[model samples]
Target: MQTFATLRTPQTTGLPARSGAGMLLMWLGIVTFYRIWVLPRLGITLYVDEAQYWTWAQQLDWGYFSKPPVVAWLIAASTALFGDDLVAVKLSAILLYPATAWLLFVLGRQLFDTRVGLRSAVAFSLLPFVSGLGLFVSTDAPLLFFWALAILALVRATSMDRWRDWLLLGVALGLGVMSKYTMLAFGASALLYLLLSPQRRAQLGNPRLWAAIALAAVLVMPNVLWNWSHDFPTLRHTADITHVEGINDKGGNVGEFLLAQLASLGPGFALAFLAGLVVAWQQRRDGRMQLLVCFSLPLLAIVFLQALRSEANGNWAAPAFVTATVLAVVFLSRLKTRWWIVVIALNAGLMLTVYHVRDIYRIAGKPVPASLDILKRARAWDVLARQLRPIFAAHPDAMLLTENRTLMAHLLYELRDMHLQHAAWKPQAIPQDHYQLTTPLGPEDLGRSAILVTQSGSAGVIERFSSHQTLAHVSVIAGPKLRREVDVILLEGFRGYR
Candidate 1:
């Protein structure tokens, strides 16, 4: 095995670093312009998740029921500066991707050559997941950015054994955790790297490593405390989804998840990434290859196993791709440029299709089916809100109530100017979401009228009210290719929370 001193030595590559930096800047400028100026004007309504985060941003907290508070914090910061418009809600996502791309470029250049760095950044930017991320607000935006930063810091810390680098790695890990719980995977990979690498194993005894761990713990302490005070709802929610406790017969889920990952990464890039994984395994003796593999593979394996046991979303392994992008580019760079170019072209086409999906469907003279249109959530909210405005104006004293969290979020954001009281139904139970937890219609609301909106009229809800009447039956268009109508019923005269 190579000694630590030998492994720490940086390799000199003939690739022009200045040119690579210039290319990164150019890409950043293009992406920034499109995201900031062009995409927001395309008339895409905010998705339910984005609206939910915006609602959360209005009442900033240390933690939320479904995830930590960083995403909400980010949205809050952006909307504060830019106002609570669609562009403002999604600003963090737009801005963060360029920073993530820049980090990928720098990490690749540090590990390999300028060509690899440029390719890796481009590959990351062109990912199908990124296509969605660039226009939508979600936890993935900040999680991915910090994940890449953590990996880069990990490389520097392991290779240089520098105290400052280790401290920086801790800060990144802490912030990543704040962004999303999946960041624990990166933390696990970092631990495994320290334990497995013979050359850097001596760092185990270094106080700096322990200090880094302590620093991360300190940074996340507030969130942990918040969870404790809130009956550990965040932990419970995470476990409920991940443990698959009540789920059975997950036999096909793993296969479905793998396929979804292929689609999410873009098929061409997925194949290249898998190939790069094999090459990294074959070249494990190289310290840099080992570092990349350590950061990239463990999270994917964990999510794959989770899929086998239960269900995993395609984006569950998103952070894994941060390092995987560099790995794929490094391996693909050894091949003819034509191979990677074809992949880039395919991915670019997919991204363009996603961006102009409505236009494409309109041009084809076809109604995008709800099943095929992934962007259906970003539609219909505006229409629904407009229809509800008159009903809300008619019942000035009535509060708004919804059984669905998604509806509650959309309505909350859409009717924000009304200043009407709203709450999610949680009769005889604990809160399931931030809205329910924060806005409980208890004894004080008894005999108070409410405008109840739900997917379907519930007998239980009718029984609790003094008198109920159906106001309007609205059809919401959802999905892209094969559009579907979702019927929403508006009810009035809910007298209490019973």
Candidate 2:
């Protein structure tokens, strides 16, 4: 291994630089285009979250019930420019991953050299999760993009202390905050980086740093005010979801989360990443290596504990990988050539397998085995929506009443052409989701007739109506793993739920 002092300077080993840049660009463009056009027609429907985000996009706001407005705004812009096709709904994710990969390229070029930059871009572009998830839109897309951009800005600001770089830092950070609350952790990571470097800590006394902080605060203030007016639903929802206050010793949960993350990043890169963290820590005397560890470790440490406490999804710590990718590449660069080849081959294999899974199965003349069809949740959603369409057509005057989040969001988009008035069947005073918080049927809507849609007929909601009848029993074979069935009930003259 190279000495610790050498870690201070980049060691650019043999890798193509100039020609690689051109090739990487071409690959990114083709992948992005495929996601935009081809993926939509490949026997998949919008995932529930994608459909919900589409509903949010229809009416732009400063804040939303469960999240900030950035995701909604992103979908709105994509659909507005591209039209309301399934491709439009997912256009944001389709485009942002490539942009994030480019940010990594730029940052790697800045910190190391063009070779590392080109390789970093190629590695990130092919991550199993990035390649697979990029086809579906969600809040994670904008969150990760803004996060990578902010890391780029921080690197420049620390190196040159330029005003423009600081401003970019503030804007990227504020946008990250709007994209996902997890971004607040970025501040902690930044602080940890500065405090660890004695020379860099002197910049804490500089005016530009404070100015960046203030600018971020100002930019994020609107969402805070929006939350204030709305009783802080976003914060509450986050707490409820994470259950951060309720902690218990669940060793198995921590192991489950780690394994899930291993699957997400792919086994090769994930193992290399952990090994890199240890190597970087040993070279902590080098400020460059220190920067990588500070950014990667703290967020992951939090998520690791979070899983032990309650639970964490595999992607919860995705932003942490923004810097970890560079560290992993740096660590792997010094190893034998075969190690690099193995990582490349593994990532490329995952990309090809996931991207063309349907084609591969079809060519073999076999149905996509449930084991390989990760799009199971997205399958047949449009078909189910089409099945529900005739019910609304038969009762045009009756308002649509949803008894759960899934129906509220899916129907809002699936049946958008009908333009039926809709409300959530919320019995409790405290809101559980976006629909319950905003459009719940209440005392004011007592006299309005409605059709209650639910998996189980909610007796509480049915009793609120003056008269009720079982309208229809709807069923759809959604996928190999999912068989959906619902009860559609007609209720007239809704009586107030007292």
Candidate 3:
């Protein structure tokens, strides 16, 4: 096995000196403080997805209808320690980025120089997408962290042929898959790297590599079994998102998807990433550059083609940027420092604006129009919950009912303290989500008086009930802009599911 000293070039041998270490530590502290303190106090409510994940955490499932179980498990762990508050729900997301940054630094330094490693760490930490992610708990947090770790482990395993590193790589891959299925893209990139590089190709015969594969397979087996038992709902959800059922055989959406990537990554980092790709291509003769490109480009191309065939999300290509961040810094560090600094500043500013968007508009004496307020969905749930609290107290025996999944999810979290017995009014046979699958109002619920809530005025549900009366009509000012109204009606005495 190759030693750590043997892996370092002259440029990196002395590069982990006090300055680099100190800089990394400083940045980690700054980011940690901001996420833990500033972000939680921003007055922004949890988005529907966040609330859904929180509800999932309470159940501690091995799988979900739309995603793997890792995110729910993460939330469960955090809330266990912190007592199930919003901060607890989001604590893992707040802390994961720094771990990701540190791993990125280790990988970058091993592949290139210490300066390149530091630059890449900073660039990744400051990425607009990452900054946004820190404020919200999602599957992406653990996914990105393990993705970087897998890359680091793979680089070490390939360079040293160490069983330990290979084993660690397997662990990272398994957990990454649990976080989000996109981790398969990293596996695809790794396969391409081995096929393209003569030196790495030898690893195909190494038993350690096969052992790694087996380990990852073993770790992911439970989720696979869960999916199989559940009719492969996760796989079906993935296919549905890709729009495979209604393929546009002739027209591709590559151009629009690329534009979305630019907007998501921020223009400066996107440009730097493109330049890095060019530089990596020109330096293809160097094995390290080839390794980076092999790990980066294939995923981008695959998603780009997917976009071409159907549609792709902006964040679908996110893991590609992990290696591209290092490549970008390596290329950008050659120029004046001002270039990278300005880009970092712009991203930071954008992050701050997102965190304090309501305050910004209020200070400027302007309302953030409903159309422009990205956080509108999160705003009015609590207000609705407050209005329903009295009604819930008055009719303690009546079960709360709603047909909308979003409403059901938010109400589950908001009224969690009340221990509300709620169920989705699934009139149809098909289950749309985990809530519908688990909490349907079945025959057992028939003849039980219920409090029915609906944004659509309950025209369809009224006839099915034994009798009903208008309890209250609520018009909530949703969003920071306060320009839109979310009107909900509470229908009392909904006596039957029929």
Scored by TM-score, the top model is 2
Reference-based TM-score of each model: 0.93, 0.94, 0.93
Q: What ranking of all candidate models by lDDT puts the best one first?
A: 2, 3, 1
TM-score of 2: 0.94
Give per-residue CA lDDT, model 3, range 1-498, as digits (tens). Answer: 334455455573366546786889898888888788886566566788899999889888779988899999988999999887778888888888888988888887776678878878888888888887777888888989999999889888988888899999999999999999999888788887787767778888989998998999998999999988878888888888888888865567888889877866678888988898888888776666776787778888888988988878878888877887877787788789899898888888988887777788889999876676776666767777887788788888888788777877888888889988887887887677877777887777766677777767577876767677677766666754462233444444445544
Clashes per model (N, Cα, C within 3 A): 12, 0, 0
Give one digit per residue, the lDDT tens place, for model 1 in 84-114: 8888889899989888999998887777666
Residue 366, candidate 3: alpha-carbon lDDT: 90
Clashing pairs in model 3, backbone N/Cα/C closer than 3 A: none
TM-score sort, best first: 2, 3, 1
| Model 1 stretches with alpha carbons more than 4 Å out | 1-15, 41-43, 244-252, 364-366, 369-371, 476-498
Predicted candidate 2, C-alpha RMSD: 2.9
Best by lDDT: 2
Candidate 3 residue 364 C-alpha distance from true site, Å: 3.0
